[model samples]
Target: MRSLIVSCNVTVDGFMAGLGNDLASLDFIVPDSEQENALAARFREVADTIVFGRQTFLDMEAYWTKVDSDMAAWINATPKVVLSTDSGADVSIWNNTTLAAGDGAERVRRLKASEGGGLVMFGGVQTIRSMIAADLVDEYWLKISPVAVGQGSSMFADLPERRSLTLRGAKGYPSGMLDVTYAK
Candidate 1:
């Protein structure tokens, strides 16, 4: 079975997005070293599919489509599955992207049962929360930033109950960003 990984950047206070849903704060926290680039490459290498919520998919498609980078190329080339309820939204702007609406957990379970490489989920707090509530996330790769955004969206909010995690590994960069991996 394929693993579903939650990969995201979070603040020291455990918030994913800053106040006003601003993501500029994260620009300062992203590691710029060659090692960090290599690590990102490895991450993309392992996941054959990229999963996103409806809003995230649209946002990413709008921004990444114009960016020029190795990661952008990888993201564009890899298959994308957007979990959404809005059937009227158009997702044809990006190549290799598909929409899956209905039971989120069941759809993810079916994807896990399929023959493919690992899957990575990145973006939109509510979607991640739903996945966590459904107990469908297999692994978490959180890049904890140094600064704390006093108020913002949290990745662990509204969880049905406490969930224990085993620390698989952690890597800290010179920028004070820690890449931590946890397994359920």
Candidate 2:
């Protein structure tokens, strides 16, 4: 079975996106450096597939497709699964992409069983919460930024119950971000 990993960047206060539901506030964190580049490369190496919520998928598609870089190439080539209810939306605009509708948790369960590599989820908040509520995540790879965004969408909000995770490892970056890994 494949491991379902929730990989995201969060503020010290546990928010994923800052106020106004934008990531501009986080621009100060995770500065562009060799370390950040290597971390991204590491994620591309470990995860064979990228999973996204509807909004994030759309947003990423719009943004990443325009950029010309190795990460863009990897993301464009990667097999992607978007959990969405909007059947009318065209997921084919990108290559190696599919839309999974109805019973998100069950679809994720089947995907995990059918695959061998890691399934890394980037979020729009609601989708991650759904997986958490269903108790379906296997690991969390969070980069905790030093600054707190006071108000924004939190990474672990409205979890159905307590989720106990063991600390797998942690590393600090010169950019003042703590890369932490936790497993269930």
Instruction: Give the winner by TM-score.
Output: 1
Residue 27 alpha-carbon offset, candidate 1, angstroms? 5.6
Clashes in model 1: which pairs?
A: none
- Per-residue CA lDDT of model 1 for 68-184, tens digit only, reads 777678788999998887766677889998888877677888898999999999867888888888888999988888887678878887876788999999988877888899999
Residue 23: error of model 1 in Å?
Answer: 5.3
Error of 2 at 48 (Å): 1.0
- Locate the minimum summed-lDDT window of 10 residues in model 2: 28-37
RMSD of each: 2.1, 2.1
lDDT for 56 in candidate 1 is 86
TM-score of each: 0.89, 0.88
lDDT of 2 by residue, 124-172 (tens): 7788888888888999988788887678878677866677889999988
